[model samples]
Target: MSRKRGKSGRRAAPRRSQASTRRSPVGANAAPAGRAANRSRILLMIVGAAVLLTGAVAYRVFAGTSPATSSSATLLASTAGQAQGETVDGISCQTSEQVVYHIHAELMVFVAGESRVIPEGIGIVGCFYWLHSHTRDGIIHIESPVDRIYSLGNYFDIWKQPLSTTQVGPATGAVNAYVNGVRFSGDPRSIPLTPHAIIQLNVSSEVPAHTFTFPPGL
Candidate 1:
C-alpha cells in the first residue's frame, strides 16, 4: 500500500508505536515490601510491649513485693500451692461455673449440642442427668446443668433457680453445697450421716466418678 506524507510531499511509512512500558522489578516489589515493612513494624511493637509488661510483672513479683505480702498474694492468686487435687492429679480442680473436675485426672464440663456459648438455651430441658448421689473418689463431683434446672418438681417452675440447694449440696463430705450460701442439706461432715450411707473411706470432698465420665478437657 502507498504511504502518505503530511508535509513537503515526502513519503513515509506510519510511525510504529513505542513498546508498552514494562514495570521494573524494584517498582513491582515495592508494594509487597511496603506491606512487609508495615507488618514487621506492627509485630515489633506488639513484641516490645509484651516484653515490657512481662518485665514489669517480673519486677513486681521479685522486687516490689515483700515476703509476707508475696505469700498472701500467691495464695490468693493461686501461685503459692496447688489446691487439694490440682498438681498431684495433673489437672486444675478449682474452677468457676462453666468448668468442672473429672475423675480421670482432667478438666471437664457439659454443654448441649455446642461449645457452651449460651448452652442453657439449647434443648437440654428434660435431658437425664446421671451423676452419683455420693462422691465416688475425689472431693467434689458435678451434676448436669440440665438436672439442676429440671429436678425440682413444681417448685422449680415457681422458685426459678437452676439448682435447688439440696440437689447440689454434698451428699457425704466436707464440701457440702449451700443454697444461696446456707447449708442446704444436713452437713455431710456431721457425725451421724444417713443410716447405711456414711463410710469413712468415702468421706472425701471431691469425688471422681466413673459412669458417664466425659473425656478430659471436654
Candidate 2:
C-alpha cells in the first residue's frame, strides 16, 4: 500500500509539469503579437508626419504667403511713402479713400521664375490715392470719385515704379504680359486696369498665367 501511494504522487507531479509546458506557448505567442502592434503604431506615426508636412507646403504655395513673399512686401512698403498726397497720372490723393466707383484688379509679377509681392499702402500715407493698395496680396483697389478708364500705367505711376517692355519695377528683361490668361500683344504699360482684371508680367522666363479668386465684396 505504501509503494502504490508513492507511485501515485510521482504521476501527479508529471501532470503539473505537462500543464506548465502547455502554457509556455501562450506566453511566447503573446510576445510576438505585442511586438507587431508596436511596429504598426510606429508606422502610422511616420505616415502622419509626412502628410502634415505636405499639407503645409501646399497651403504656402496656394496662399502666396511664403517667406520670399513676405520679404518682398517689406521691401516694397519701405518706398511706398515717397508719393504721398501727390497727383499721379491725373489720379489724386484724397483725405479719405473713395469708393463711389470702387473696383479691384490683381497684378502678378514674376522675375526669373519667382513671384514678387505687391505691397500694401501703395498710395497711402497721411491720405489715400484713387489708385491704391490695401493689402500685400497684389490687389490694386481702384476707388475713384468718377467712373473712367484706368490703365496699369496709371497705377505704376502712383507706385512710382517703371513699367515697360524692357523694364518692370526694378527688374530689367524682356517682359511678357498676360491679361485674364490671354497673351497681351500691346505694350505692357498700356494694359488696362479693368474691373477684376488679372494681369501678369513675367521677366526673362515665361510662366503660365494664374487666376485669382477675389474675396467676397472685393
Candidate 3:
C-alpha cells in the first residue's frame, strides 16, 4: 500500500508540473498579444492624422481660399495674364529676378471694410518680373537691374488692374489712399514703391492708415 501511494503522489506531481507548463505558454502569449494590440493602435493613430491632413488640403484647394490676412478677404488671382514676358509701364520680365535694386513694399486694399489679398506670383509666369509679389501677405517685391523709382501704377499695370480715385481693381467707389500712415493727397497709383513703404487703399470707407514692420532680411 505504501508503494502504491508513493507512485500516485509522483503521478500527481507530474500532472501539476504539466499544468504549470501549459499556463506558462498562455502568459507568454498574452504579452505578445498586448504588444501586437499596441502596435495596431499606433498604426491607427498615424492613419487618422494622415486623413485629417488630407482633408485640410482638400478643403483649401476646393474652397479657393487660404489662411490669409482676414477671414473675409478675397484672394486676388495673378493678373499677369497674357503679359507674362511683356513690358508693362517700363517694368521688364526677365529670365531671372534681379537683385541689384531689391526692395519690398506692403500694399493693403480694403473694399466695403474687408481686406483683399494681393496674391503671390502676380508678376511670375514662366519668368520673373521686376515688380512682383512673392507672397500673399501684401509685400510687393521690386527686384530690378536698375535702381530707379517705381510707382504703384506700374504694379497695377503689371497686375492688369485699374487704380484711381474712383476705382481699385474691379471694385469702384470713392477710394482713399494712404502712405506710411499718412493720407496721400495725389493719385493712389502715383504712390511710389519705396523701401518698406506701407501703402493702403480703401474704397467706400476709410480706415486709419497703419504701419507695417518688415520681416528681417526682407
Candidate 4:
C-alpha cells in the first residue's frame, strides 16, 4: 500500500511490491558455522576431563607401590626363610611374658681397616618392626610383645642399608658376619638378636675385635 509522487502529477501508480530483501552470502553461512564452533568447544572440554581422570588414577597406582613398601616386603620374605626353627638363623629371643620385652645389641662395621659409624635414629619411620635402633651408638633396641626371632637382617632392613652375603652398604666385597666374637658361615642376615649381643660386619677387610663397650643401662 505504498505510492510515490510524480512531477506535475497527482499520484503515480502504486509501486510494485518491493523486491524481497536478499540475504548476504556471509549471513546465510553463519548459522552452521556457529553450530560447528559450539561442537568444537564441547569436544575440547571432554578431552580435558578425560586427561585429568587418567592422571589421578596413575598417581594412586604409583603411591601404592612406593619403593619403601616394596623394599620392606622383600626383606620380610628373606626373614621368613630364616625362621624354620625356634630362632631365626642365630637370632632368637622369647617374646615378653609381660606386656613388653626389650633387648640391647651393638653393631660395628669395618671397611678396609677403617671404622664406619652406624648412624643414629634408624628404623624410626613408616611401619616399624620389633627390632629398631635407638641411638647413633649403633645400639639396636629390640622392643617386642610377640615372640619372634628377629635377626640382624631385620635391623639392616630397617636401616635400609645394602646387606647380603656379597655386599654390605657401599663396600662391595665378600661380607664376613660375626656374632659375639664367633664367625657365622650362613647368610649375614640370619644373625640373631640376643640380649647383650655384639654383632659385627667386616666388609672387604679383616673383622676387627669390637672395641665398642656397651653404655651403662644398656
Taken over the whole model, the C-alpha lDDT of each candidate is 0.29, 0.80, 0.81, 0.63
lDDT of 2 at 155: 84
Report the poorest 10 consecutive residues by lDDT, candidate 2. Answer: 65-74
In Å, residue 17's CA in model 3 sits off its true spot by 41
Candidates 2 and 3, the one with greater TM-score: 3
> Comparing 2 and 3 by lDDT, which wins?
3
Q: Best by TM-score, which number?
A: 3
Model 1 accuracy (lDDT, Cα)? 0.29
Lowest lDDT sum, 10 consecutive residues, model 1, at 113-122
Candidate 4 residue lDDT tens string, 159-178? 55667988876678878887
Q: lDDT value for candidate 3?
A: 0.81
Tens-digit lDDT track for model 3 on 48-133?
99999999997556334222355567965546463667888877899998999999998988887778888888888889989988
- Show the colliding residue pairs in model 4: 91-192, 120-136
- Tell me the tens digit of each residue's lDDT in model 1 across 1-218: 76777698988766555544666789899999999999999999999999999988875654321222222221111111212222211212223322222221111111111110111111112221121112112112332222232122221112121223233111222333222223335532232211122121112243322122222342
Distance from true position, residue 20, model 3, in Å?
38
Q: 3 or 4, which is superior by TM-score?
A: 3
Candidate 2 Cα lDDT to native:
0.80
Instruction: Report the C-alpha lDDT of model 2 over 86-193, residue by residue, as the tens digit.
Output: 687788998988878989999888888778778778888788989888777788899999998799998888888888999888888999999999999978989988
